[model samples]
Target: MSEQLPAPDPARFPALDADPSWVLSVPEGTLIARIFRAGGTHPVAWHEFRTFGPLDGRFDPHPLPVGEHEGAGVLYGVLERGRGGGVADGGALGGAFAAALLEVFQAQRMIRLRDGSPTLAAFEVTRPLRLLDLSDSDWIAVAGGNSAISSGDRERSRVWARAIAQRYPELDGVVSASSLVPDARVVALWAGAADALPRYPAALLPLGRDELIGVIDRIADRYGYLVL
Candidate 1:
């Protein structure tokens, strides 16, 4: 039988009453990379604000409240803060792309990229965004939480996210180091930051597109993940 991982200390979870101010600024023109289903709730240029869920994402605010918190959408992306440029720059392999890919397909050792019309998109943040920066160890401590918030039980983590949303509703969303790729920062934007998305993506293409085939291959090869 698979071992049941021990739950993180409940005392270390973000306190419902703790006031935290560890926000990070994602500046205008910053590149955000994502891999999304073209036909899903989050199509290109879409921020999923309309639907709150009982889903399994660590930070998806469940039972999203009405009143002030209503229509508080969320967008997930990897910040293209890596050196040597991004995917739009000469198709160079970037940490953001690799991180995004791993986030979606890590459950399977072999990633079947063709199954979902998985599309890769690059968005430029149009304005400054303030996000709860949980990636920092000190910031996590300030919230009375630990690194487990970023890499722990999804159900329990969502409980913490709900607390954050209730305590700091003005926050755009949360930012954390990718659980799969610690060096690559990931973002989840709430509070309807759709204006942050330009009318058109900076770059958009399906993973199966001819130009992206090599990029996907390189990422899979570099990470020792099988691509089919």
Candidate 2:
């Protein structure tokens, strides 16, 4: 395996020379789809920053001392526009299902139905969101980073997120291409924007349900993933 990139140094990294035009605006009422555990944190809750490592989320807040930095939260999701209940490309899965499936079970390549009872939830944002678009190469350059922000080492990406959060406090979060899904985009929202999440998800489906198993089976068949 290639050596991992070192984390970005706050003092030595290039300055964040950002532009207002680089911001991506998600209109109010845009539905965001997520695969989460129903028994874990609420679907709309911002996950508090707690750990720092390669396994930590790419855009989770830097875990500094409580007083050392602005306390932050993060929510990861994908847009709901094209996630209709249909499998395209004959047998290949597409849209949020494939994106979320590959992302969640990437390590094991096994879809475990009972573990945490994984559920798919879709919710609408109450207000428009202004997000840093890291998917744009130009924006990455202006943000003092590169494509690593989307697909490189997560440890380094988290450091880059810290710098961006410090520089652009007004931003609700960011949008980046999914490392596992080439054609998919994923969103990471900061905790300060919790007001945007609706009280309840507009749609929810527990993967363990008997009815959903057929769909899951098809995904496994297409991708050669094992379902447990």
Candidate 3:
């Protein structure tokens, strides 16, 4: 179970309103494929994928086998118009984020997103990912700041989050405390877990394909949300 915290207050997050309104789940394989394909061309994204850690705000690239990031989920996040630079909706972005079910089969992989210059860098979590998701919910607000969102007691949050997710898969990505952005509240799980994880065992994510689909379906029924 997670530690008790104050109930969420949406009022504190006025800034987030302009942030990403919805999240599109990308499967682990997709990200691995992206990393693999981009390794030659986009070495920056690939290296960032290899040694990106959010526990502390720093880029200490470490080399490891590609299998290390096996269970990681590559999130092709969605952003709508009129929010945070009015990033447009659909197009390459839409096609990139529509794989909630494929993401479930992700084994021992996890990814962390960082707002970098002209692009977002995907950092690989060393810990075995227990759960992860994309959402506008304010359940996991930890502190306010650009770096605070990514480096606070993130490991603690991940452990607690994973336990909760195991019981309620839909809640897996609902409430993560780790932050790699200047300001972020939602969570994404298991696309880089294997690399940093001590074991090579099959990825044991909080939710399977069916459970993730349910969460996706529920969110889809709501307003201001979309899978792609």
Candidate 4:
């Protein structure tokens, strides 16, 4: 039987209160994963895992093959307590978990989200994603999709755009998955366009779907804290 690993701690990591966060610069056909850790502080971490050509009905629920452009994948990790910490030997536990996950990706031939959405096949892991400190209102502005409450209309867009600006006041503009504005500090994830929305001035992130997942696991292993 496989050994059970301890869960993450909560006191160290906190939960994300903001709804509708945005991930910008995702390459076309890339998969994004968002893992939400229950009962923890700073429970949110974004990872850009792998890139794949396309997905082939291996994973279920939201299975969609990669488009013409190379696709990328992302994952979110939330740390909760009951997990181990302060381990010796350079924390092999986390490294082992990451390696095992990679093996699974190769065997399954794809990565699936908690909702069972297909994201990536196989790729590499990138740098760790750190969420900047921003108010809940500002988070909603950048992360939240165009909704009845925060529509993408001229007025609403301006409102949302303003929120983003406030958070990263220093930024020239905001970029979202689909839209981009020069001198802005927000971007959205646009899978169809295979390109960043025009107007925003931030670096575009081109990655594979699987690469996203790898990053999520790493965060969960490294900084994830615990309680009790």
Candidate achieving the largest TM-score? 1
Query: Sorted on TM-score, highest at the top, how do the candidates line up?
Result: 1, 2, 3, 4
* Per-residue lDDT of candidate 1, residues 1-228 (tens digit): 422223334445454235445677778988888878766544443334534563666777656443334565556788877546665343323668878898988887576776756878887889988788887636666545677778876777777777676666776788898888898888887655777777787777787777667777877888888988
For model 1 the local lDDT of residue 117 reads 68
**TM-score versus the correct structure, for each prediction:** 0.81, 0.79, 0.27, 0.20
Q: C-alpha displacement of 78 in model 4, angstroms?
A: 3.3
Q: How accurate is candidate 1 locally (lDDT)?
A: 0.70
The parts of candidate 4 lying over 4 Å away from their true place are 1-48, 53-65, 80-128, 132-137, 142-228
Candidate 2 residue lDDT tens string, 95-140 = 6666777777877899988777687766788999988887854666
Residue 186, candidate 2: Cα error in Å is: 0.8
Q: Compare candidates 3 and 4 on lDDT and give the better one.
A: 3
- Looking at candidate 2, the ten consecutive residues that score lowest on lDDT are 45-54
RMSD of each: 4.6, 4.5, 16.3, 17.6
Clashing pairs in 2: none
Query: Model 3 over residues 1-228: C-alpha lDDT tens digits?
Result: 434333223344333224343223333322211112222343443323332332221111112232343232323221111112110232232222222222221222222111121122223233333332222333244221222223444443333333433333332133222232222223343334334422221222222234334543443444223333
Model 4: per-residue Cα lDDT over 32-72, one tens digit each: 22222222342322223223322321111111344433323
* Deviating ranges (above 4 Å) for candidate 2: 1-21, 40-55, 65-70, 81-94
TM-score of 2: 0.79
Please give the lDDT score at residue 154 for candidate 4: 33
Error of 1 at 187 (Å): 0.5
